[model samples]
Target: MISKRKLYYLLSPSMRYSIRKIYYFPSDFWDLISGKRDKTIPPKGLIFIGPGDFKRIGEHYLNIFKEQCNLLPNHRVLDVGCGIGRIAIPLTNYLNKEGSYEGFDIVKNGIDWCQKNITQKNPNFKFTHIDLKNDLYNLKTEQTANNFVFPYQDSSFDLVVLTSVFTHMMPDDVVNYIKEINRVLKPNGKCLVTFFILNEESKNYMKSNSDFNFQYNFGDYSLMDKDVKEANIAFEEKFIFNCIKENNLTIEKTLYGFWSGRPKNESFDYQDTLILTK
Candidate 1:
């Protein structure tokens, strides 16, 4: 039996709707929070949550990730911070028998869930847990709990996708991950990263609303202008472009607002999808 405290914590109001929306299999409150569950599989080809309007959101992002990959039949792909095979599964289905896919994440439950629910009998799909604490990718010996390091050899993958992963990371963590991504990507390899950025449009939206007290950061994650108390510490276009330039990478293509629902403005949108290459 699960404890009431644990159950309540797992099903917090903020996450309850999202969890209930996605999971259909038997996931107790404990299982939801602990991310472990007994074996009782859903039918094959059936999305556990069933196809609905919400699934379209996932599909839209999947399409964006695929467009960024522009994958060849023989290309090897990497899905970093792959959450419960959301993107990884679709990418595998897209590749079919043509290409290979490897996904990595720090959370064991997510990998376990993917292994049981998403991994097909197909030999092309592989999933692994990356431990930054162990310096898995030979990343600097100083390992922090927040860092995620990939364990693949240099130039192993043709394409890497980090959809929505950097949105939750701090600025320092994003920079470290970018360096690690550059290390693993083959020469001429491409990467696509998504971010929740503060743009001129978002700033104006906040400013126009007298009730909303939000401010925008001026091209720096560390500093925020007055009235902006909480800014999403992800990448701004300028910051990301500078990082790419510093790393000697070329901007292959940049697609903005493809999946983000932010309102348009004179300067920018609230979200951006960037595609970079070396």
Candidate 2:
């Protein structure tokens, strides 16, 4: 029998997304009437990305931002792939009037729900819709991620974030985004991004099949699913480091995760988290 994940990827991107929304709609409807869901949280049917508990994961990142990234209430924040306000909701309570949040996503409905729900209460929080093409998430959009320019001024943000966005992107797209991150950040600004960094240690860990093994080799990067281009990508360590260096961004820290078979209890996240400074 074909595995469910492989079978799911066989369907077109539009069909895959529609099927997920449909699958989760009944529970979301029930939660709406029963008042089991929080106001800031998006309905399950509408959430297009990310894994694990929605509210908990958002709060978890908030803590990381405050504790690890030294995020301040008055600093400007940018979320590259703010899907359904998972990270934005927690930030609303944290950022004071002097601070602001800007997020953009390819999916229109997530942005619509966020603007209607979150932005109404917190005027400082804003969302913009950009229909960019990705193999797993979006396909019909005219714009390509590789050369897309961020609609923002240079040296504007104090902190930039890309939680799980790069994992779904191609190498060229990520390189361009890194350059954009360097451009948009103020002097000494910080960026906290996550990726699957394929270094020696991570390679050793992936010897077992239990972990997230990027078995399909594709030069500098590898894919979890061979045919599904954007399903999950892991970049070689040298390529990632070189990209950061070429973009004039310095690596501040590297926190490897448990996805490559490291002890789960010892890891902070499933993907390797890197803190960079510009």
Candidate 3:
């Protein structure tokens, strides 16, 4: 079993640095953060591109963003798990001058990197460092002793997004975040989230691999193992639908295969994009 301390170590700044290198974040972005350069040029190449080539990978995420968010010029968007400004920066550009964007993450490095690079040109964009692992979901005005603050008032945002964030969270934490999203969202607001879903096909695929196991608890399902075991954490389609129902949100759309499941040539079936309206 993975302990909370091990998870913290994995998320530590030094470990994150190594992970970034392994993931091939732009060298200039790292150089700027390390004070090796006075100024840095934002990377133009696709950061998440795999052996499939850039155009194919770009089309995948672009379509996912468009279908999931249905982004508009006048929208106010909150990106709950903005990592290194991957989606948030590009999304700010996509929204142009008519919209406002805010992003928060558990990692300070991500927030700091975004503020330094993306927020420079997009003055309306903002980033905050918030530790969601702690029970600071309510985010009161005077509760400034935490790692960061959420300045916007309740029901201020038109959309809130938690892309690939729920895939790593415990089931209780996932429910809490759904409640918090409801609290921050306006009556007409929407939320877009992505996750790995464990259905029958996924279960069979895991069984074939012999390196995975599916664990089910009170309707919540996850795959657990030693190496890449945390990837096992997943939700049933009904669990997501029920969470939205309980929160009084309506499902707008669902997009499948954004990341293409395992057995690499399977054509991006692992990711699920959900758009929910309040």
Candidate 4:
């Protein structure tokens, strides 16, 4: 049995978007009529990313940013792949007027919704849509991710965040993004990111978890679906470390998430996390 996500990748982006709307229409309508959905949260149909409760996940990361990343009220932050303002929504409450946020994503609708909903209220938060082509999430754009330059000055951000971003990117694209992240980060700045790391132990766990579709293995990385390489991927530990070392970034902390069928309480986050410093 394959995962629903793998099945989703078998279709085009427009078909996937339509299916999502059809699948969530009943629950979204019920939430709206019952008033159970929080006013601040986006409509269920609009939240394409994330696994669980959006606000809860956002708040959970906020705590980690404060305690682990040492994010300050005046820190300038950058959020790559800021889908539908899920992460940005929580930060609006935490970041004062002194702090600012800038986010960008490949999906135009997500960025459009975010701009209309989140940016109008909080002028400090901004979102942009980049036309990058990805097999899993995007195909309409002809722009390639490997050479795309980030629209920011050098040493611009205090904290850079990329949650579940690298897992969907190819190896070359990931390296370029890492270099771009290093370039945009101020000296002594930190970046928090999540990945599905393939190691000896994780390989053993993958045997037990059928939901994870990292079956097509390359030397350093594995793909969930060969047809859609960006649908899901797991990287080798050495490959990840080598990229970090070569990119002028130093590891500050590493926490392996329980994605490999380990006890949920044993992990810090759902995916393997790393905090790197420039």
For model 4, give the 10-residue run with minimal summed lDDT: 1-10
Q: List the RMSD of every prediction in angstroms.
A: 8.4, 1.2, 6.7, 1.4
Better of 3 and 4 by lDDT: 4
Q: Which candidate is the best by TM-score?
A: 2
Please give the range of 10 consecutive residues that has the lowest summed lDDT in model 3: 134-143
TM-scores for candidates 1 onward, in order = 0.66, 0.96, 0.69, 0.96
Can you write out model 3's per-residue Cα lDDT over 8-125, one digit (the tens) per residue?
A: 3346344545564666656656766887643332233213111343334434554665665666767788888676565664565467677788888765656777798878878989
TM value for model 2 = 0.96
Better of 2 and 3 by lDDT: 2
TM-score of 4: 0.96
lDDT of candidate 3 vs native? Answer: 0.62
- Write model 1 residue lDDT over 84-122, tens digit each, in one string: 666665565567576788888754555677777666565
Instruction: Order the candidate numbers by TM-score, best to worst.
Output: 2, 4, 3, 1
Number of clashing pairs per prediction, in order: 1, 0, 5, 0
lDDT (10s digit) by residue, model 2, range 1-278: 77777787789877877888899989988888998977778878777786689999999999999887899999899999898899999999999999999999988888999999999999999999999988887888768888889999999999999999999999999999999999999999999999999989889989984446788998899998988888899999999999999999999999999989888888878899999999
In model 3, the clashing pairs are 223-232, 260-268, 260-269, 261-269, 261-270
Q: Which stretches of candidate 1 lie over 4 Å from their true place?
A: 1-55, 96-98, 131-148, 208-219, 222-232, 258-270
Superposing every Cα of model 4 onto the true structure, what RMSD results? Answer: 1.4
lDDT of 4 by residue, 1-278 (tens): 86667677779987887888898999999999998988787887877786698999999888989988999988999999888888899999989999999999998889999899889999999999999998877899888889989999999999999999999999999999999999999999999999999888888877899877488989989998899898788999999999999999999998989887766788888899999999
Point out where model 3 deviates above 4 Å: 1-13, 19-63, 134-151, 209-219, 226-232, 258-269
